[model samples]
Target chain A: MSGGRDRGPDRGRRRGHSLHAFRAILAKDLRVELRTLQSVPAMALFGVTTFVLFRYGLDRTKLSGGLAAGVLLATVLFAAILAINRLFVAERDEGGFDAIRLAPVDGTALGGAKAAALIVYLVVLEAITLPVFALFFLDSWAGLAPVAGVLALADVGLAATGVLVSAIAANSRARDLLVPLVLLPLLIPVMIAAANAAEPLLAAQGPAYGGIGKWVGVLALYDMTFIAVGFAVYDFLLED
Target chain B: MKVPSLRALSIATILCLGAGFTLVFFYAPLDADQGFVQKIFYLHVPLAICSLAGFMIAGVHAIRHLRSGDPVHDARSYVSIHLSVIFGVGVLLTGSIWAHASWGRWWVWDEPTLVSFLIVFLLYATYYPLRYAIEDRDRQARYASVFAITAGAFVPLNFLAVRMAQSLVHPRVFATTSGGLPGSMLFTFLVCLAGMALLWTCLVCFELAAKSASAKLSRLRRALEGETYAAPNRSRIAPSVPSRAASPLT
Candidate 1:
């Protein structure tokens, strides 16, 4: 009776894909990470350096650099592109993608792991970029709070969307050029939101970029919309 | 398999196109504000809306193809979206000219209608590169269909995003929040919208015929190639798309 139940389609669950399969994918990716340890450090170094250049580029320093914060989400986003551009390349290059697809892994689960890994990678970079900018330019406590929140939210959306694109690029020819070209245009809106919302915070002006309520709502909407899309579409993308 | 004829459609299109313009010139009262040139709104706004509708149809077919995996639906959808791009180009041109005429500038960074179309233009322009990159017939269809479906998000997101970015310069004369258009203007606007929509249908049907024919021709050509497919072509055709066609435009 136990064997029959365990082997049943119902017990197998949802077209034979299992949560264990999802967990296995997460574990597989982590094991791979433990072996290489290359991507995270490269992404972190690139993200930190890019953030510093922008904050340092400003002349008048304090107030001016603050104003630049909201707008320079584009720069951080470019750093994201650089970091994750090779995301699925390793899977394709080593011919491991096929084995993974054949491993009973749900596409969403696999995408979730990669996205989780990328977010972890990007957040480390952000951990470097944001603090360096904070010590150098961001001074006020009130301003710092919202700016940090918005930036964190913006990075999630960027990474999720970027991961899907990176998959498409990795599969195609002239992949390196293709990824960034497609990515940067899509990144423009998030850059707009991040910049506009963070502007007042940077400048210590009244937070009136459509009010904090409207501004953060846009970022949240963007995050939910893209993450859902990335998860659903990643299956089709990853299925060879 | 079957599509409706364009006969009555085009006749109605021509008649209404004439009638729509006539009302714009003769019937609608002059604005209490901008005088003669304001009449361009009758033509400009409807055309933009018509193109937006075209984009929406393309997006719908894109989703249908992705879900159902039917090549026929994919062809139809690709046709609808292709026509949308053609119509969208027209919208940008006419609207920009009118903008230049009124505002003394060809482009405004803060205009909702203008910038929104710019984003749409950029988005659809990439559609070609997307098509060229993938080799699978059905996968190409699937990817394109999904991209098109996802584009609906861009239309609204761009519109809303642009509005949030700055104080919009484009007039909201038609917006209900701005008290709506006067009755005569409203009537002319609706007629114009109907006329443009009819014209769009005709164009989409035309392009649908062209695409379906082209696809059949390519399949027939491949079949004619007969032996070996040059040996390399068979495997190459399965996955690696023609590299040049797939490159990003910049």
Candidate 2:
């Protein structure tokens, strides 16, 4: 560990090394997830099943433009909800929150770490779902690249919001129901931007990059705002 | 200085709203485009603006509650959101009426403002359930404040994103044919806006007073009878007013 490498300044700065705490939490979550196979696989499987349901429900062999964007975004959003609903369960069950509070580290680290973990889960879910979406509904792959950018920004927004909401719902009585009820409305703007941006790229003729930048900018703004807010208010949520 | 009594504010709200309605019907000229249907605009827009403002005010109160650790701020935040959600119903109903009268549809997704309000209303409607699901009083207040702040920030961004999504395809429907509001319409709109704002304030004050009175009565009952007479009930979704109900304004 780097704890002993710099003994002088590091000793004085130990409490402020929230980054170290954040990394430890993130690593712990990732390790547990890897071993348990808890969230990612379920999200990916849910995404695939939703795509199949869309095929049967919409009664379309293939989809394009706004319809395609809506279907894909909604599917991915539900999958994200599946992941988010479970994000804080381990912490609540195992008394991880008390441990975090007792440690000499910034409380926001838990929020940051949880958000990062959710982002990782989302990325993995997308890796599996995007290909299936293309194979099932997309007429061309040209738009997929730009759509990836939209997805990334949207994922950050989703993770930041999901982690905060999950934390709030964790100690509540109806934890499972409270998460989705509170989370969906908060994610509407992200879904709006992602769907609008993807609509052009997923057009039947070919991908168009014309208006994608504006929507991506909206997504980025939403991400930054929620991340800052989550960071600022998370400590209040943690205080016993 | 003494705060203006709730009775005074309620009377002022009545006068302003009455005068605003008269101006809408008799003073302002009918629009060349939509004629009588456009009248709903006077009611709809003001309600929308007031409701959104109420949500933001709740957010401010939530910030205070979180910072000061005061239950009064939480009560204020809860009441503000409660009133705003009621106003939100007005916005949606009036909006639907306008849509039906203008476009022959009961609901129109093409109107970005209405759609955005719908999204926001749905979001805030969950606030009660969220509060109910939390059993601890203090924790519920804190979490509700967090929700309020987050949802408040979401209001403008949601409007912007929804507007952008619609702008590329649909021309905005609520604008006057003259490209800018004429003097008479603008005056009438301003009056209605003021009236709605006043009504919102009056209702918030009334609710606060009612809640304060209820809390004091409960305290009095406990004082005269005993603790067992006013036993602590099961947790409620509404925020509990602290026993210090002396300052309803806070």
Q: What tens-digit string does per-residue lDDT give for candidate 1 at A141-220?
A: 45666677888888887877787777777776657776776666666677767777787666755344446567678878
> Whose DockQ is greatest here?
2
Candidate 2 backbone collisions, by pair: none
For each candidate in turn, the TM-score is 0.84, 0.93
Find the candidate with the highest lDDT and give its number: 2
Candidate 2, residues B14-120, lDDT tens digits: the string is 99999999999999999898898898889998998999999999999999999999988998899899999999999999988888887899888877888999999
lDDT of each: 0.68, 0.88
Off by over 4 Å in 2: A1-15, B1-4, B168-179, B231-235, B242-250
Model 1 has a DockQ score of 0.43
Error of 1 at B196 (Å): 1.3
TM-score of chain B of each: 0.81, 0.91
What candidate 1 gets wrong by more than 4 Å, as runs, is A1-18, A27-37, A48-60, A63-66, A139-142, A205-210, B1-4, B177-179, B214-250
Q: Choose the strongest candidate by TM-score.
A: 2
Chain B TM-score, candidate 2? 0.91
| TM-score of chain A, every prediction, order shown | 0.81, 0.94
What's the residue-level lDDT of B243 in candidate 1? 21
